[model samples]
Target chain A: MLFALRVAFRYLTANRVQSGLLIGGVALSVIVFVFMTALIRGLALFLTVQTTGQIAHVEMEPPRRIAEVMGPDARFAAQPISTFQRQQIRNWQLMVDQAEQLDHVVAVVPEVNGNGFLVRGTAVAPIALQGIDPSQIDAIIPLSKSIIDGSADLSTGGLLIGAELAEDLGLRAGVPVILRSDRGIERLIPVTGIFRIGLSNVDRRVAYLSIAVARPLLALPNGVTSVSIKLDDPALAPLIAEQLKRQLPLKVTAWQEKNRNLETALESQGRTGNFIQAFALIAIMISIASALLLTSVRRRGEIGIMRSFGISRGFVASVFVFQGVIIGLAGSLIGSALGYRLCLFLSEGITGPDGGPLLPIAPAEGGYVLVIVLTVVGSAISAILPAQAAARLDPVEAIQQ
Target chain B: MTLLKAEGITKSFRTGDIDTLVLKGVNLVLEPGEMVALSGPSGSGKSTLLNILGLLMQPSDGALSFMDKPMSGLTDKQLSAIRNTHYGFVFQFHHLLPDFTAMENVAFPAAAPAGGISAEIRDRAKMLLGRVDLTDRIDFAAMRLSGGQKQRVAIARALMNKPELVLADEPTGSLDRENSARVMALLREINHEDRTSFLISTHDPEIAKCCDRQINVVDGRIA
Candidate 1:
C-alpha cells in the first residue's frame, strides 16, 4: 500500500498541470454545492424568523361546543350551538403554568381577543382588540421595538392602536376615543401608543389594551379568550402542540398549520437545492473519472512494464484509486473553506435596505463535513472504472503498443 | 532439478475470425545457472517463447514447469507471484518508470510485493545499482539518464528481487554498440557472480556467440 501510494503521488506530481486542473474542477463543483445549500437553508430560516417573530408559535383555545343528541336510538347529527356567552378558557392560569414549564416554551401569555370599533369624532374604523397583561406586552410580537410613536405603555386604562387604525380614526397620543365592543359595551379610552409591525393585517386592524380594563368591556371577567405560546424554536411548534393536545383538553394549533404557503415554499426551495447539489456531485464524479482514464491511457507503457516484471493488477488499480482519493480530499477541503469565506463575506459585508444581511446566506450551514465526505467517496468510486481498465491491461498488448 | 522445462508447447492468437499459430510443439530444458540465448529470424516465435517461459503469456497447449512444479492450473495471481519471486525480465526497450529515480525503479519489484521499501530493500537496490555501475546516477530520474544508463538501470531493476532466472528479450536492442556491449557485459557479470540463469532472445549472432549455448528457431519450432 505504501509503495502504491508513493507511485500514485509521483504520477500526479509528474503532471502537475493536469492534476491542478482536475483538482480545481472538483473544487469548483464543491463550491457550488456548498453555496446552494447555504443559500437555500439561510433563506428558509430568514423567512421563518420574519414570519414567526410577529406571531405566537402555538395557540391554545377553548374547544368548540357542538350540541349532539343524547338518546341512544336518536340520530347522531352535529348541531351548532348559538350561545349568548362567548367561549372562554376558565382555567387559563393552570394551562399557562403548564405551558411555561414545558421544554422550549419561552413565554405563555393569556389574552382576551375580540373585535370592536374605534371612533374619534365620527371617524370610525374596525379593530381586532388584543388584551394582555401589561408586563407581557412584547412577549410574542416585540411591540416595543415596533412602536413608531409614543410608548408601548398600556397601563392606567390606556389603549395601544396600530398606525393605520390611529390614522383612520384621526387619533393620537393622549386623545380619547370611544371603543365599542362586539358585545355592544363601550368605553372611552386614551390612545397611549401607535406601532407599525410591517404586517398589513396587524398594522391596520389590531389594537392592544391591558387585560384588567378589557375583562369588563368584553364581559369575560374571570376567564381569558385564549392562551398564546411562544417557543424558542418555531419548527418544534407542531410537536409541542401535539404534546399539549395529548396532555390538555383544549384546542392546540401550531403556526405551521396557519401558514401552509410558507411551508410549501420552503419545501420547494429545499428540493431545488437538492437537485443543484446532486448535479454538482455528478459533475465532480464525471470530471474525475475522465481525467483518471486519460492518465491510465497515457501511462499504459509504464503499467505494462510494471506488469511484465510481476507487479500485481491489484497494485495498479490501487494506485489509481489513491490518486482519486488525494484529489478529492484536497479539492473538497479547499472548496469548503473557500465557500464558507464567500458566504461570510456576502452575509456580513453587504446589507439590505432594512440593514439586514443582503443574501440571507448562513456560512455556518454550508454542510462542510457532508460535502467533504461525499466528494471523496464519490471520487474514489468514480476511479473504479479507470482502475479496472488499467488493471486488466495485457502486458503483451500494452508493451507492443 | 531443471530451472525451467517446456514440453510440446503451443501458442495461438485469434485475429477476428481466424487463429494463427505462433509457437509449435517444442521441448526444452534450462538448468539452474546456465546462460542460454534464443536466436531467431524476425518472423520466428523467439519473443513468444520468451514471454511464455517468463509467465507473461500462457501456452495454448502442453505443459510447462519450474523446478518440477507444473504451471497448468495455477491462477494468474499465483503465476504472478511465481514470476516475481523466481524470474526477472529485461525488455527490448528500457521501460523505466520515467517519473521515478533510478533507485526507486530498482526497488519497485521488491517494494511493491512487500508493501514498501524497507531498509533491507533499499540497501539491496543500492547494491544492485552500484553493481550496474550507476552508483552516481541512482538519484537521477529515469528519463534524465542516457540510453546506456537507462538500460543499466533496467538491468538493476530486473535483479532487484534476486530472482533465480533473468529473461532478457533483446535487452540491448535499442542501444548503440557500446551501450549494448556494456549492458550485455553487466548481464554476464551478474550471471557469473550470482549464478543467475539467463534466457536472452536476440537476432544478433555476436550476442548469441557470447552465451553458453544458443537455441535457434526457424518457424514456430526450435531448429
Candidate 2:
C-alpha cells in the first residue's frame, strides 16, 4: 500500500496544477454543501422564533377538570380547562421557580389569562387579558423592544393594549377604558402603551397589565393561571417539556407542539436540503472520477510495464484507489476549514440591527463532521470504476498502445 | 534443466470478421544459462514469440510452461506470481516510469509485489544500478536522464528480482549504435555472471553475432 501511495503521490505532484485543481474543486463542492445547510437551518430557527416568538415555547397550565376537586369518592376529574373561570394554577409561583431550574429553561414567568370585554363610549369588543410581572416578562419575551407606541410602562399603573385593539376602541395612550369580565364585573383603567407583534389575533383582542394589578381584579385569592417558559435553545423545548410534565402536576406544552405549521415547513425544507447535498456529493464524485479516468488512460503504457514486471492486477487497481483516497482526504479537510470560516463570514453580513442573525444560520460541530465524512467516502467511491479499468488492461495490448 | 519451454504456440489477432495469425506452431526452449538472440524482419512474429514466452500474452494454441509448470492449469494469480517471481522483461521503449528516480524505478519490480520498500530490496536495486554503469544517475528521475542512461536503468530494473530467464523484446531497437552495443554487452555480462538465461529479440545482426545461438523467425515460424 505504501509503495502504491508513493507512486500515486509522485504522479499527482508531477501534474501539480491538475492535482491542485482537483483538491480545490472538491473543496468548493464541500463548501457549497456545508454553507447551504448552515443557512437553511438558521432560517428554520429564525422562522421558529417568528412563529413561537410572541408566545412562550412551553406553557404550563393547570390540568382541565370538571370540578375543582374530586368528590368524597375521590375519583379523578375530567373537564375542559377554559381560558377563563376559576382555572388559575394553585401555587404557580413555586412551579415557576422550579421550572426555571430545569435544564435549558432560560426563563419562566407566572401568567394570568382571562376572557373579558373592553368598552369605550358606544364601542365595545371582546378581549383576552394577560397579566404578567414586568421584571419576569422581560426575560420571557422582548416586550420593551416590541413596543412601538407609548412606553412599555406597566411599571407604574395602567394597561398595555394591542395596536388594533387600541385603534378599534378609539383609544390611545393615557385614555381611560372600561373593562368587563365574563362574569359581568366591570372596571376602568387607562392605557399606558401599545404593542404590535405582527399577529392580527393578538393585535385585535389582547391586552396586557402588571400581574399585581390584574390578579386581584380577576377575583383570584392566590396563584396564577399558567407559567410561560423561554428556553436557551428553542429546539430543546420538547425535551425540557417532557421532564417538566413528569415533575409538575400540570400540562406542559412545547412551542413545537403548539405550532405544527412551522414544524412541517422546517421538515420539508430539511428534505430539500438533503436533496441538494446529495446532488453536491454526486457532482464531486463525477468530477473526481472524470479527472482520474484521464490520468489512467495517460498512464496506460506505464501500467502495462508494471504488470509485465509482475505487479498484480490488484496492485494496479489499488494505485488509482489510493489516489482517490488521497484526494478525498486532502480535499475534505481543506474544505471543512474553509467552509467553517465562510459560514461565519457570511452570517455576519446578513443580519438585522438587533444583533441577532436575520437568517439564523447555525454551523454546528456535528454538522461539519457529517459533511467531512460524506465527502471522504464519496471521493473514494468515485475511484472504483477508473481503478477497475486500469486493472483489467491487457499487458500486451497496453504495451502496444 | 529447461528453465522455460513452449510447444506448438500460436497467436492470432482479430478485427471484425478477419483473423490475422501472428504466430503459428512455434516452439521455444531456454536452458539454465545461455545467451540467445531472435532475428527476423518486421512482422515476422519475433516480438510475438517473446511476449508469449514472457507470459505477457497467452498463446492461441498449445501450452507454455515455466519451471515445468504448464500455463493452461494455472490461475491468473498463479500466472502473475510466476511472472513476478521467475520471469523478467526488457522492452524496446525502456518503459521506465518517468516520474520515478532511476533508483526508484530499479526497485519497482521488487517494491511492486510487496507494499513497502525494504532495506534489502533497496540495496539490491542499488547493486543492479551499479551493474548497469548507471550508479551516478541512480537518483535522477527517469525523464531527466539521457536516452542511454534511461535504458541502463531499465536493464537494472529487469534484473531487480534475479529472475531465472530474462526476456528482451528489441531492447536495443530504439538506441544508437554506441548505446545499443553498451546495452547488449550489459545483458551478456549479466547472463554470464548470474547464470540467468536470455531470450532477446532484435533486428541487429551485430547483436545476434554475440549470442551463443541465433534463431531466425520467418513468417511466424522459427527457421
Candidate 3:
C-alpha cells in the first residue's frame, strides 16, 4: 500500500500543471456545493424559525364549524349554526396537563385570542387582541424577550402593543387606550410595553393583554380560546399533532399545516438547490475522471514496468484510488472554509432597514460534513474506470509503446 | 545446474486466416552463472523468444521450466512470483518509470512484492547504483538521466530482488558507443560478481561476442 501511494504521489506531482487544474476544478465545485447547501438550508431554517418562532408549534383548539354543505336537493339541507357562535375550549386544564406529559413537549400555554378595535381619537385600527399570562407566555414565544420597550408585564391591566400598531395609534408605554370588542363591550387598558417582532404583518395588527384582563372583556369566563404548545423539536410538530388528534377531542394543528404555502415554497426551493448541487457534482466527476483517464494513458509504460516487476492489478488500481481520495479531501476542506467565509461576508454586507442582517445565515455543521462525505464518495466513484484501465494494461504492448 | 530449459518451443500469430509462425521448434538452455546470447536477424523472432523465456508470453507449444518447476501449470500469481523472485527483465527501451528517481526505480522490483520499499531494499538499491557508477545521480529522476544511465538504473532494478536469471533484450540498443560499452560492462560485472545468469537478445555481433555461449537463430530454428 505504501509503495502504491508513493507511486501515486510521484505521478501526481510529476504533472503539477495538470493535477493543479483538476484539483482546482474539484475545489470550485465543492465550494459551490457547500455554499448552496448553507444558503438554501440557512434561508429555509431562518424563515421557518422566524415564522414559527412567533407562532405555536402546535395549537389545540375547539374546531371551527366547517362551511355548510349545500345539498343537491335544496329541500334536504339542515339548519346550520349561526356565524356568531362562541369559540372556547371545553376542558383546558386537563388537556394542557396531558400534553405536558407527552414526549418532547416543552411548554403549554392557554390563551384567549380575538380581533378588537383600538379607538384613539378617531383612529380605529383593527388589531388581534391576544391574552396570556405574561410569565407563562415566556415558555412558548419568549414574548418577554421580544419586548423592545417598557416591560413585558401585563399584571396591572395593561396591554403590549405592536410597534407598528403603537406608531399607528400614537400610543406608548404608560398611555391609556380604549379597546372595543366585537361583542359591543369596551374597556380602557394601559399600554405596558411595545414589541417589535420583525414581522410587519404581525407588528401592524397584534396586541397582547393578560388573560385576567382579556377573558372578561371577550365574555369568556374560565375557558381559553386555544392552547398553544412549544416542543423540543419544532420539526416534529406534525407527528405530535397527529398523535394528539387521537388522544384529544379538540382540533390539533401543526405549524406546517397552518403554513402550507410556506411549506411548499420551502420544499420547491430546496429541490432547486439539490438540483444545482447534483449538476455541480456531475461536473466535478467529469473533470476528475477525464484527468485520470489522461493520466492512465500517459503512464501506461510505468504501469507495464510495474506489472512486469510483479505488481498486482489491485495495487496498481489502488494507486489511482488514492489519488481520488486525496483530491476529494483536499478540495472539500478548502471549499468548506471558503464557503463559510462567503456566507459570513454576505451576511455582514447585506442589512435590513431596521439594522439587522437581511439574510441571517445559520450554517449547520451537519451540512458541511455531508458535503465532504458526498464529495469524497463521488470522487472515488469517478476514478473507477480509470483505475481499472490502468490495471488492465497489456504489459508487452505497453512496454513497446 | 541448469537454471532454465525449454524444449521444442513454437509461437505463431494469426493475420485474418493466415497463420504466421514466428518460432517453430526452438530449443534452449541456460546454465547457472553463464551469460548466453540469442542472435537473430530482423523478423526472426529473437525478442519474441526472449519474451517467452522471461515468461512475458506463452509458447503455442512448449514445455519450459525454471529450476525444475514447470512454468505451464502456474497461476497468474505464481507466474508473477516466478518473474519477481527468480527472473529479471531489461527491455530494449529501459522502460523506467519517468515519475520516480533512479534510486526509486532500482527499488521497484523488491517493493512490488512487499507493497512497500523497506530500508534494507533502499540500502541494496543504493549499493547497486554505486556498482553501476550512478551513485552521483542516485536521486535524479529517470527522465533527468542520460540514456545509458537510465539503462544502468534499469539493470540495477532488475537485480533489486537478487533474481537468479536476468533477461536483456538489447540492453544497449538505444545507446552511443561509449554509453553502450558502459551498460554492457555493467551487466557483465554484475553477472561475474553475483553468479547471476543472463540471456540477452541482440542483432549486434559485437555484443554477442561478449557472451560466454552464442546461439544463432534463423527462421525460428537454431542455425
lDDT of 1 at A359: 97
Best-to-worst order by DockQ is: 1, 2, 3
Relative to the true structure, how large is the alpha-carbon lDDT of every model?
A: 0.92, 0.85, 0.86
Winner by DockQ? 1
lDDT of 1 at A312: 95
lDDT per residue for candidate 3 within A36-151, as digits (tens), equals 88778888888888877878999999987654355456566566333535778868999998898899898899999888899999999898888998678576666778788889
What is candidate 1's lDDT per residue for B38-116, written digit by digit as tens? 9999979999999899888999998999989999889879988998888888989889999999999999999998998
lDDT of 2 by residue, A308-401 (tens): 8889888888889888888888888888888888888767766778886655777663167887888778877899899999998888888989
Could you tell me which 10 consecutive residues in candidate 3 chain B have the lowest summed lDDT? B73-82
Residue pairs in candidate 1 whose N, alpha carbon or C atoms collide under 3 angstroms: none
Best by lDDT: 1
Score every model by TM-score: 0.95, 0.92, 0.85
Residue pairs in candidate 2 whose N, alpha carbon or C atoms collide under 3 angstroms: A42-A360, A42-A361
Predictions' DockQ, in order = 0.83, 0.79, 0.60
lDDT (C-alpha) at residue B45 in model 2: 93
Give stretches of model 1 more than 4 Å off: A68-85, A120-124, A166-175
Query: What are the candidates' interface root-mean-square deviations?
Result: 0.7, 0.9, 1.3
Report the CAPRI category for model 1. Answer: high
